[model samples]
Structure formats: structure tokens, C-alpha cells
Target chain A: MTERTMTKADLVTSILLIVFSAAVFLISASMPTMAEQNRNPLAAPGIVPGFIGVVLFLLGLAMLIRSVRRGAPAFFAQDRGKPSEVDRSSWGRIALTVGLCLLYALLLGRVWFPLLTFLFVFVFVTAFEYDRKAPAAGQWKVPLFAAILAACTAASVYLVFQYLFLVNLP
Target chain B: MFEGLQLFGQAIVSTFTLRALFDALWSTQLGIIIGMLPGLTATMGVALLTTLTFHMAPNNAILILICMYIGAIYGGSRSAILLNIPGTPANAATTVDGYPLALQGKAGKAIGIATTGSFLGSIIGMLAMVVFTPLIGSVALSFQSFEFVWFSIFGIIICGNLTAPKDPLKGWIAGFLGLFVAMIGMEGIHAYVRFSFGSTNLSGGISLIPAMVGAFGFAEIISVMRVERYEVVKTKIDRVFPKLSEVFRYWKTIIRSGIIGTFIGAIPGVGEDIAAWVSYDVAKRGAKPEEREKFGKGSIEGLLASETGNNACVPGAIIPVLTLAIPGSAPAAVLLGAMLIHGVRPGPLIMIEFPTFIYEVVAMVLLATFMMFILGLSMVRPLVKVLQVPRQKLMPVIFILCVVGSFALQARLFDVGVMMVFGILGYTLREMDYPMAPLVLGIILGDILDKNLRRALILSDGNLAPFFTRPICLALFLLTMFIVLSRAKWFRALLAKIFRKNATA
Candidate 1:
């Protein structure tokens, strides 16, 4: 990242960390000490986390001070232009990858293991390799290759995990 | 010593069987392929394989993982030499001299020297591991809760300091964040859950394998997808073996680099990357004027030092894991986790409980090193083909493995979700320039820190005197303080001023 971008990111991160640490500290302080159960107060479940929360807060404060001193707030005033086509394409690809992964994860147990895996791999490869600039007639090869790879991968993974490793697939 | 040697002999003899050899061959080959692939790291490879080896005998499983570890660390140099891209972060230093050699049409020679250096380095590291693990284990047996509490903190501090040299504050934050993640599960002593938010899955806590696969595997998949593709540098191979005299000419550099690498690897949370860089820098400093001039311009000594240092670190990194249940590197942390899953606890008591196990580990490293050397030299062309596999085609398969690897441990879908969350968190942290080593170390050390700190407190009846007074505890505490303070600009300026005054005097 550029210096300006890093400054802004650090500023936002420090604030979030500060908030998170404070929440941790408050919640930890409210946890039961188990005194009535004859537990040593020093051994309370919240003790270590409470200490961590305090340290994290101090670290966050340091980051906050450093970013502010670096003029993080001033960077916010700079207007940014629209992303280039390459950047937009990269973002689209990332979004598509995440969406497919989420869909696969969500449908994992509900669907047949091999089938779901095969579909996920096939769709992912096809989506990435499908060149919109290319002629539509040329796209069949990419999907065909994807299909073979997906099928092989799905079969091997299922057999290995289930039969070889003795892991019961969901 | 004799008994140890005897056990080491026995371990070597037992591992010489056909089945073990087969396991060693295939696992090492897989490790090399994984390492040769950009965005696939030794840590990720070990973590993913841990799930696969779950059903095997403990010794066999550990043997396979060790092979993978050694092979992967060595395999990274292939890409570094051939494509100028360090397949793993550990091989980043190798690219300096390696790619230059490749560009000069000596890629085959570079790979040859690298493989030899890796073999020698592993041997040196293995020797060090044999000598040091028992020594460290014996010393660690005397440690109490007070010492352990400080030790864990020291590990986190030093790890953060080294991993994020540009900005250690972010490193510390990542480490502490990992510690907090570990807090979600039930307290080890009282079984009281904190930060679970009333979820049963949360109370069981984040499993290490899932979190690791997500952070290293899934996050890598995403990161790899974001980058543009790289082209392979095609160089003809006239020679694949370095002359013995050529290798032995830099014997001093090899030994020096090996020692430096092993020492750096023994440092908690530090890994092969730093080891390689430090060895490279040291070798350059120690080289003659003419040789030094060729440091990054395809110097044989530089490549040898870097390759050896990193390979040595693989064994060096395992030392602390065997002795203190603390990982010397990220990959070692996963190995530690695997050991735990296999019901072989590695800590201060390892020497007493499984005295021969250390020897067994040594044998495994030895076997893996031989396999790495053999496969590295013999299969250069075939391994080069692995680098040509398109990321778009390969990444989806990797993602599928990540999903399966995460879920295979417990067959719980919740773990898969944990993997996703950690993957995003890991990617974001990477983008922000935060180091993941300290974060992973923090997760591994969390339980030890939490349980020990509380136990120390209770023993002292809330008095903090023993924490300050005990020799080891005091040493660790002071070291941690020194590291933290040394990072401060004011402290550095003050030290610089003092040095200037002293020089004048």
C-alpha cells in the first residue's frame, strides 16, 4: 500500500481495535470470580483475557497516536478517482470467487459430497477461464477441460477422504 | 550418549523398511510439488497433510509430515532459480543469486548447488536437533508456571518484533488478537468458557487445523487469484550436478550459514525466511572482496548459503516444538498440533516419556533429507512441469482441499465456517502489513500463557514477587521488556547517543 492508504487504514484499524479492546475489558470485568465455589480469584477465567485486553488497548492507542501524527486525517480529504478497468476486473473476480466459495460452503453438507465438489470446481474454473473477449465458439474447450479436472478432483477427493483415510464425508 | 546413539540407530533401522521408504518418497515428492507451486507454503502443506495422516500410526504419520517439511523447504528454490519467484517465503533470499544464474543459462547448475546445500544444511540441523532437544528438554523440566508465563510473552514479543520489523505494533496486535481467539474455548483449569457468546461450537473453541487451513490455504488461494500470472524462464540443462570441489570450495560459508540458520530457527516464531536472509547477509560480509562483489549477481556462495540456511532451519525450527511445546516456526506449529492430535505430547517430559521419539524424529529428518536430495536431483524436468500448472485451474482444487481438510478433522460444518472467517481475517491482516507468524504463535501459546499465568498467580497468592525473582522468569521478563523497549524510537536514539559518547571517550 501507498503511504496515504496505509495511514488511513491504520487510523481505521486502531479505532476498531480500541473499541474491541474496551468491549473485551468490560465483559471480562463482569465475569464471575467463582469465589463462592472456593476458586482462587487470581485463577478466574477472565484474568488473562482482561490483561490481554488492557495490553491490546495500549497498543491500539499507540497505533492511533502514530497514525494521527502521520496526518491520517488529512489523507481522507483527498478525492480518489474511479478504479481502472483492470482493478475493476480484479475486484469482480475476487467477488465471484468469494461468492462461489460461500455457496459451496453453505451447500456442503446438504448436497452430495462428490457432486457438490465437482460442481464447485467446474464453475470456478469455467468462470475464471471464460474469456468474454474471445469468440463464443472457442469457449467450449475451457469448459470441457474444467469438467474433466473437476470430475477427477471430485472422485479422488471423495475416495481418498472416505475410503483411504476413513473419514466419513458429510 | 551411547544409549541415544543406539536408539538413533534403531530408529534409522526401523524407518528403513519398504513401506516407510515409500511413504518418505511420495510424501517428499508431494512436498516438493507443493513447495514449487507459488502461493503454496510449507506451513499450508503440513497443515493440510496433518488431516490426511490422521489414521496412520503416530510414527508413520509424523515421519510423513517431516518429509513434507524438509522437501517443501528445499523445493522452493526451484521456482526461485527457474522463475525468479520464491515459491515459499522462505526461499525469497534464494531468488537474489538464483534467478541471476538462471538468466545466465545456468539454471540447472543453480538447482544442483541448491539441492546439495539443502542436504548439507539438513544434516547440520539434524545434528543440532539431536544435541539440543534433550538439553533444552532437560532444562525446561525445571521451569515453573512463573517462568512459562514470561516465556510465552517473550515468544510473542520477539516473534512480533522480528516478523514485523517495519511496524511491530501491528504484529503485537495480531498476536494478542490470536490469544483472544484462543480464549473463546473453555478455560483449561476450570472449564469456564469466555467469549463464546453462548454458542456450543464457540465453546469448543476454534480448532487449530481449520483456522490454519483458512489462514494459510484459503487466504493464499484468494491472494494468488488477485495477482497476475508469471512466465517460466526456460533454460537448457547441460549439467544437474555440481562438482564436489566446487561445493567444497565454499565449505566455510556452508558451515557458517548452517550454524546461523539453525540458531535463528531455534528462536520461537522465527522461521526459514529470516534464517535464509540472515545467512545470506552474513555470508556476504564474510566473503572475500571479489566473491562479495558477486553476492547478488549469481554468486554460488550466496545461493548455497541461502539454500542451506533455509533447509537447516526446517530442522532447527522443530527443536523448540520437541522441547517446549513451542513452535520455532509456523510450519513447526502445525507439526506440534499434529503431534498433539496423534497423542504424542511433546514438551519438557518428552525425554522421559518418549526418550526414543527424539531419535525417531532425527531419523525421520535424515530419511527426508536423503529423499529430498535424491528427488531434487533426479526429477528436475518433471518438477518444473508442476510450476506450469495454471493457477486458475489449480486454485479451485486447492480450495476444495481446504474445505475438506478443515471439515475432515471433526466432520463439523462449523469448522468450515471458522476456516472462512479466519481466511478473510488472515487476508485482511496480510494486506495491512501485519505479520501472521506472531498471530499463529499467539494461538498456539494462548493456553500455555493463560493456564500458567493463573497458576503462577494462585501459587503466589496474588503476589507478583516470584515472577520477578525467579531466575528463568526474571530472565524471560527482562528479555521481553528489552525487546519491547528496543523497538521504541526514543530508546534507539538514546542508545545511539550513548554509543557516540562512549566512542569519543
Candidate 2:
């Protein structure tokens, strides 16, 4: 019977936001004077910063009040219902992707882009399907699909950018 | 009438060459495949493909990019209908009705309906572009520094409001933040350093590609890794074509969506996703009570409305790009690059510069749509079967491409660093509730918003009056207000009450 909403997170976020907005408003207000001293109109404008800060502060305060009045749904504390029904993507999948991407970035100059991207795409996609209780044939579907996608993408890049455009592929 | 005939004739002559047709077919087909993949996008396809076209004859190159541009947008609907996940941002609206229909074992009907909608939508957009490009171009001719700022702001705001869910305010806030981010490094007006913090690289602000990659691609992938694999429910799809009766039943939805899609696409920076959603909403609201209940559960009209709207947007989006040299979407921006690379400088006087270029473009779009219809119908089952290919081998290949795409941008190791940093940042942000589209729009529109606003002030000797005073500006301001207000619960309720009262009275 748990229901999750963004209100509680909004509550904590709003308080910190109000404080931050006030600080920004103050700093922005001061910067114009500093800019005037330094002869720069770009430093700060009274209407712009004032409008932004006050609005942010008010919005945050309202949200903060709303959060405190209505406690966070118990679902906020746990995964709640079967997550397959939700739009949420999982962390491990995200991590593997980030790692592969980071590895590609790190290897950008030492190796060509096509090589690195292909590896990352293949490994990560395969990893996503690794643990599935599959109908035998489909168990390795993830890796295979990932590989084909990687290969086709790389070959297309080569045919177009390198072969056609004369752009060097890293 | 004679002039129109001649223009069409020129378009045919320019585009009918064997080489041109071949290139168009290949690029369009390639764009279709790229768009069908869930992670790959039309914008990315255009960008990568443009890189390939750089060395070709400008005419052929522009044709390739245009074909890709048209094909990719149309292709996205395939994934939306079959997999229940949009293959491109523009296809997000398609999933709302499309996936539901697939689950109900009506995949073929939905796909066929979507394809027809897309084809008609494209034709409408192209015709609009043909008719209105001159009229709009004339208005743009008078635009200077004074108007560009308002135009840029309008673009960002409209994009923000339309893209975000229940929070156009949040989206605009994010957009303005992006504008602020653009203000970093050297000031556009005088190169007076603002937020560079004295870093020499910061002096030029940030490169556009890195920021885009960081915000969109990198961030998206990161979130993917964080979430373990998702178990998406997908049912088997049969032949994905619609019957004549089914398509005819949704004729009203198709027409309205076409008009709406074209109009939105005409606006700079907005694209297919917005068109689809807006049209879907229109279809839902316009439906009778019985029909309304079927809106999200795969009603043929819902599928038709969104697919038509988004696909039509491609032509609409391209109109402004060709006429004004300002892009209407991310892929259009890439297409602009292709145009510039191909020596086809699109601007207010593009017609004068290259008399038949506009017609050629229209013809290319028409050809691309045909290719999309053919490819999408034939490839659905084969595409699904592609997954039948092993993890270990695939990873290495995908890893290679990622590296190559990044490196090819500038041939600089620094760009690679920029890509990685942004990728990580993108991944992190995805985990949070921050939407990636606004950030991409931000990076894409950042400099335009900053430069134009500053230029407007400098041109006016530092007066902000023109922003609120101009006809277009006034309209945009009101829209922005309405958008923010509508996002509020009270405003929504108030609107509902007003509508209810109006209906009864």
C-alpha cells in the first residue's frame, strides 16, 4: 500500500535551494556594484537577478512546506512494486555503460574511436542480457545484438566519414 | 504558376541524376536503420553522416544529409510501435499509443497507420516549406541583432515548455541555466571574460560537440548502466501495415496532426517529439467519449496522430533552416552543417543564391519518405531477429565505434576528455530526475541565446524595450506565461473548470 511521489525529495531540496537562491541574489546584487566600479554592465542587473532569486526562493519555500505537511510515501523508502512496471533504469546497467564510455574516452587518442566504441557497445549490451533466464537461444541475444549494432555503426562511420567525407576516424 | 512549375522542374533536374538518386537512397536507408535502433538517434545519424559527406560534391552531399534527415525521423516510429520505446526523441509521443496497441496484438495495424501518417505529414510539411519559405524569408530579411535575441529566447522557451512533463517551468529554468552556461568564457559582445576563471580553454567557452555529447549521449548511457537491464514486455508483431479502412477512419486526426506538426516544426528549435505529443493530446481531447477511452491503449487514431505529427515536423523544421540558416532541431543543425560544408549556404536569399535548391530539397524529402516506408515495413521482423547475434564479441565492436565517433570530431585528445567528462556528467544526471533533452537544447541554443541577447542590447545601446514590445516578442511572452501557469495544479483545475462551464452553457 505504499505510494511514491517527488514531494519529500522536493522538501529537502527546496530548503537548501532557498538558502542558495538568497546567496546568489545577494552576490548578484553586489556584483553590479562591483561591475560599476570596474566599468562593466555585464556584471549584474538589478531586475534580472532580483527577479530570478525571489522567484526561486518563493517556489522552494512553497515546495518545502508542501513536503513537510505531507509525509513521503512509504514507497520512497523501498523499490515498492515490481519496478518493471516503472520507467526507472537500473544502476548496474548505468555503471557498466559509464565505465565503457569512460574507457573509450581514456583510450581515444591511443586507439581509434571505432575500435573502442565497438568493444564498449558489445560488452555492455552483452552484460545487460547475461543473467536472463532465457529460452536457451535467447540467453546470448543481448551480446549478439550489441555486437551487430557496434559493427554496423562502425562500418557506417568508416564508409561515410572516412571514405566519403575524408574525415579521419580516431 | 509558371514560376512554380519552373521551380519544380529545376528541382527534378537537379535531383534526378543517377548519382544523386543513389546517394539519397543509400543515406535514407541508412538513416532508417539508425533511427530504428533504440539507442541511436536521428540527430546522431545526421551528425555522423554529415561527417562522411564533407568531402563529396556539395550537391550530392546535401542530398545525402537531407535524405538521412527525412529518413531518420520517419524511422523512429518503428521502434516506438514494436518495442514500446522511442528510437528517437521525436518518437516519444508514438510510444504512448503505439506500445499499447502492440500489447493488444495490433502491431501491424498500428505500424501501417503510423507509416501512412508519416508519409502524408512529410508531404504537408514539404508543401508548406515550398509555399511559405519565401514569405517567412522576407520577414527574416528584416531581422537584425535586435530581433535575433527575441527569436532565440522564443525558440528555447517553446522547446522547453513543449518537451518537459508537468514542468515547463523547470524546463525553462534549466534552459536559462544553459543560457547562463553559454555566457561563460569570453563575452560574445566584447570578449570581456566573465566566468572563464582564467582558464585559456575556458576563454572560448566550451566546444559545442563536447557539451552536447556530455549532456545527451554520455548521460543517457550512464543511466542505462546504473539501472540493471530492464524487462520490457514486448509481444510478437505480424505484418506491420494498415488497411485502407483503418487509415481512412483516422483521417481527421491525420489532417489536424499534419497542420499542427507543420506549424510547430516551422518554429526554430522545436521538433517532432513536441509535435507528436501536442497532436496526441489534440486527438485525445477531440475524440468522443468512447474513442477517448482508447487513446492511450493503442487507438489507431492516437498512433496516426502522433506519427503523422512528428514525421510532418521534419519538413516543417527544415523550412526555417533552409530559409533562415537557423536550425529548427538538433538534426537540422547538423543538416545545416552539411549544407555549409556542401557550399549550399542557406539563408534569406538562398533562393536567389541557388534558384532551385529549395525544390531539390523538397524532392529529396519526398524520396526519403518513400525509402522509409519501404524499409520500415520490410525490416521489423529482421530487426528483431538481429538480437540473435553474443555479448563478448559485440561489446568489443561497439566499444570501438564509441572511440571513433569521439575522436573524429576534432582529432584532439582534449575533445575526447571533454566527451568523457560530459558522458560521466550525463550518466550522473540521468540517475537524477533531470531530463537530458533540455540540456542538449541548452548546449545547442546556449550560444545563440547569449550572443543574440547581448547583440540586441548593444544594438539598442543597452535597452531591453524591444524584447517586450515587438509583436512576435509579445506573443512569445504571453505563451511563456501561459506555459508556466498551466503547469501549476491550480491553473490546470481552473482551466478544466472553465472548459466544463463553457461546454455546459
Candidate 3:
């Protein structure tokens, strides 16, 4: 099948880039043009960023033109006639994973690292286990095996990084 | 040259200890495992290893890091061949012919060929490093602000051009974005905070290791998770070594790719991924029509070119780091940082100051390549099993590792947060087809570019003429412009017309 024309995502990404470039340009402009430490205006902290801003703006404009010429669809419109399996489930998976990561990050330094890691891995594996093909034995075996594997992973990582390598863990 | 040889001999002696040998073997094995797993890359492998090796002796630590870097780059071909999912970006070209070979039930032979290609490519690169580094170091001594500025720009431009073949503009954009990201901290010239907005954390700027982990590691995890299921190929194993005749037949391709890979690797800020692609493209272009049909369909020559080019790049990427204090790739940048941390400075005066260090690095690379070859051939069966691990189970572990890696760099939770932010950003950018190589290179090169440009201008007393007038500067400027503009439709069309006319005559 032929690829779809520019989708709404392309247009949105281009516009976001344009806005980002403009923001960088403004921030660069606000930096000290001539510093007391150096007499040359060319040595200003803002010079390179200013140039990068201009390049980014031009690039964003190019992207905008290309996306427009290719016929951008609406923001919420689907790219294909029917949504595929990934299209239907990817968002939920992403959100759930992100949420798990957020919790892990929050708990990283507060609790014992190995313990926190074990819990995080356990939850993550359990959540993803349902999606895998079932073993021939029984449904209960999946979570039990996942928990054991998660514990081993966490303990191994802790031992390797903390004891062997002496990397101070958070 | 005599001094270099003396130092090389000393380096070989230093690395002969049982402890050193064990470090090299263990690190290389770990590197290969990381490289064979989907969602992990050579850059991340080196970065993570750097933190862990902080306490070892400089020689041992550096040996392990070098081994890991080489092994990881070589190891990536396994998954690329077996599952069509490149363990690292550098292996993407391998997937073209390698996966096809696996589908034809020659996976063992493909892996064996890849191993030989990596060994020969690395041998060539190591030889080049030994011979050319002193010469480059001497030449680089004269490189001033103008040359450095142009060099950094040239790196970014060429990298963007190579990575995003279809749309270089997007590549350039991603690169500049990375430069902007680098600008969000205290300026080196005056120590004046530019974009910190009074936040103490922002003043130190974003950490490179964390940002890189986010871009390549976490970003990969997110991308891999987005795909629900991937097609897996099953194949029977035969011999794990290619015939001597097969190796001899492809000697020309291997040598050509080695030369190309080393040359590209010597260029600052470029990496193995581009080397592989460029070598593959050149090989494809030069192939006879009948032989060309075998390309992308299990051609041994195509796989050899790609594997050789990328493997050679590991040592090529080290040339600038040792001679010029400039990194040839993202991993090289991290290696540069690690060297500084280990109190070994790599620059023009390295021969004068730390004369034996370069030779030590050369020895390390040589040892690493041998280890990689041995491990690659022997561990082929077990390593291929990594491809069978379900992505669902593998990704979360990868994600947790990303978290630990980012935090382990400086013991900063904020860096972990930075990784998360970049992970989301990288995922979005990847979805939109923007390449990540230039972005990472831009970040790595930003400070060098910024400092050199201003320094050149200041030295010239606000005159911009020297930037374009100096011989090296002029050449670099023209080369960068040529590479950037050569991708334009008009330029290609015009070149095509000229070539067609010449053919007709």
C-alpha cells in the first residue's frame, strides 16, 4: 500500500518547531550582548544560539511548506481507513508504562534501591504478562514466574552495580 | 615513530596481567550481550560502563571501556540478522542482507561472515590508528579556533546529511535543536547563566550521559513497546565459520569498506551507523547488475561491507579523541569524558605529556577486537536466543536500567527526569522520521562549536574573513556546503544528466 500523505501530526510537529525556534530567538536576544569579561561583541554568549535559532526557524518553515504541499489531514483524523491493533492499544500501554516509570522515579532514592527496583519490575512484568501467549500449564504460573524473574533481575542489578562496580545507587 | 613503538610495547606489557585480561573478556562479553538485545545501543553500553569503571586503574578501566565499545558495535549484527531488529543503529544496514540470509536458513553462516568482517575491519582500523594518530596529532597542533569551529560545523552538517538521507533539513533541525539544548546553561566564556532563569540545577546544564541514555535507551524502549508484535524468523544452525575461500573472495570489499569506515570515523562527531550505510551504498553502486540483485536478499558482500565498515569505525572514532581532544562520535565523547575523569588528557600535547596513553589505547582496541571475534563466534548460539525474548518482558527491564543509568552518572534525580523528558521527545521525533544521530552529535559538539566560533572572531578582532580565508577553514567550509547542498534535487538531477550524457558519448 502507498504511504499516507502528511498527517495532522506532521503539521503540528512543524508548528511546534517554529514556536520553539522563535522562543529560542527571543531568549537569545535577551542575553547580554556585550559582557564586561570580554570586549568583543562577537564573543557574546547569545551569538551561536542566535544563529541556531535562525537555522531552526528556516528549517521549520521548510517542514511547514512540505507538510502543507503534501495535504495535511485534520488533527484527530485517522491515517488509514481502519485503525490497526497498535493504533488501538498503543496509547493505553504508553500511559500505563509512563505512569509506572513516574512512580519508580519518585521512589528511587527514598527507599532501598534494590527493593524499589524489585517492586517496580514486579508490577511492570505482571502488567505486561497478560499480553503474552499463555503457557501450556496454567494461567497462575505467569505471575509467579514473572515475580521470580523480577526479583532475580533486581538483585543481580543491585549486586553488579553497587557491590562489584561500586556505583552508588539512588 | 620509535617512541610510539616503545610506548606500544610498554602498553602491551601493561595489559598482560590476569586482572586486565579478565576485565577485557568480561566487559567484551557484557558489551556483546547489551548489543545483541533490542533497545540497547553501543553508546549506552559505553556510557553505562564508564560509570562502573570509575574506580579501576586507568589502564584496566580504559581497556574494559574500549572492549565494551568495540564488542557492542560488533555484537549488534546478531539481532539485526536474526530478527530484523537492529540492536543498534549501526547494524541497520546489516539487517538489509543479514535478515534475508537468516530467512534462507543460513543464519549461522551470516553470523560467521559478520564476525570475520568485524575482525578484519577492526584490524585495519587498529593499524591505521597506530600509524596515523601521531601524524594527525602533529597536524592538529596547528589547528586553531577557526579550524575547530569549522570542524564542529562540518561534523554536524555531514552527520545530518548522512543520517537523514531523504530529508536533510529535518536532520539539520534536530541537530540545531540539540545545540539549543546545550545552550541552556552557564556560558563558558563568562560563566554567565543564559537560560537557567535563576534555577541552580539548570546552571550546571543537562548532563550528557543522561541525555544520551534518554535519546538512545529510553527512546528505543518506548519505540519498541509501541509495536505490539514483530515477525520472528526461525532457522537451523550449520557451521559457525565461513570458508577460507569465501573470505578471500570478498577481500577487496572488506578492504574498501575498512578504508571508508576508518576515514569516516576519523571525521569528528560522525559514527559507525553512517559508516555502515555509506559503505553499503558504495558497495551497492559498484556491484555488477547480476550480483546487485543479491543485495538486500542475502548477499554476502553487502553484509561484509556493512559489518566491516561499522566495526572499523570503533577504532576510527578513537583517532580524533586521542589526537585532537575532539570526539569522533557520541561514544567517543563519553570516552573523552571518562579519560578526563581518569586524569589522562588526550590532545595535541598527548604525545608530549602522556606519550604512552595513545599506545595503551591502541593495545586495548587490538585486544578488544580479538576478544570480540572469539566471543562472537563461540557465543553465537546463546546470543541469538536474545532475539526470542518477548519485547513485552524485555522493555521494562530496559526502562529500569535507563533510570538507574541516568541516576548513576551523578546521583541526581533531576537527570533521571531529564532522561524521561528526552525519552518522550525522542519517541515523538522518531515517529516523525527525524534521525537522532545528528541530535546527539550536536549536543556533544555544541560547546566546542560555540567556544571556537567566538574565540576565532575575538582573535580576528571582529573580522569574519579568517573563518573563510584560512586554508583549512576554507576547505572545511566548502566541504560542509557541498555535502549539505549535494542532496538538493537540482544538484542530483544536474549530476545525473551529466553522467547520462557522458555514458551516451
TM-score winner among the candidates? 1
**Candidate 3 lDDT tens digits, B77-188:** 9889988988888899999999999999999999999999999999999999999998999898899999988887887787777677777887888888888888888889
For each candidate, what's the DockQ?
0.81, 0.27, 0.59
Candidate order, DockQ descending: 1, 3, 2
- The residue pairs that clash in candidate 1, if any, are none
Q: Could you tell me every candidate's TM-score relative to the true structure?
A: 0.98, 0.79, 0.92
Candidate 2's residue-wise lDDT over B316-340, tens digit each? 8888888877677767766775686
**In model 3, where do residues sit more than 4 Å from their true spots?**
A1-7, A34-39, A73-86, A131-137, A159-168, B230-232, B287-290, B489-505
Which pairs of residues have clashing backbones in candidate 3? none
Ranking by lDDT: 1, 3, 2
lDDT (tens digit, per residue) of candidate 1 on B174-243: 9899888888878899889889899999999888889999999998988899876899987886589889
CA shift at B479, candidate 2, in angstroms? 3.2
Question: After superposing the true interface residues, what Cα RMSD does each candidate give?
Answer: 0.9, 5.3, 2.1
Docking class of 1: high
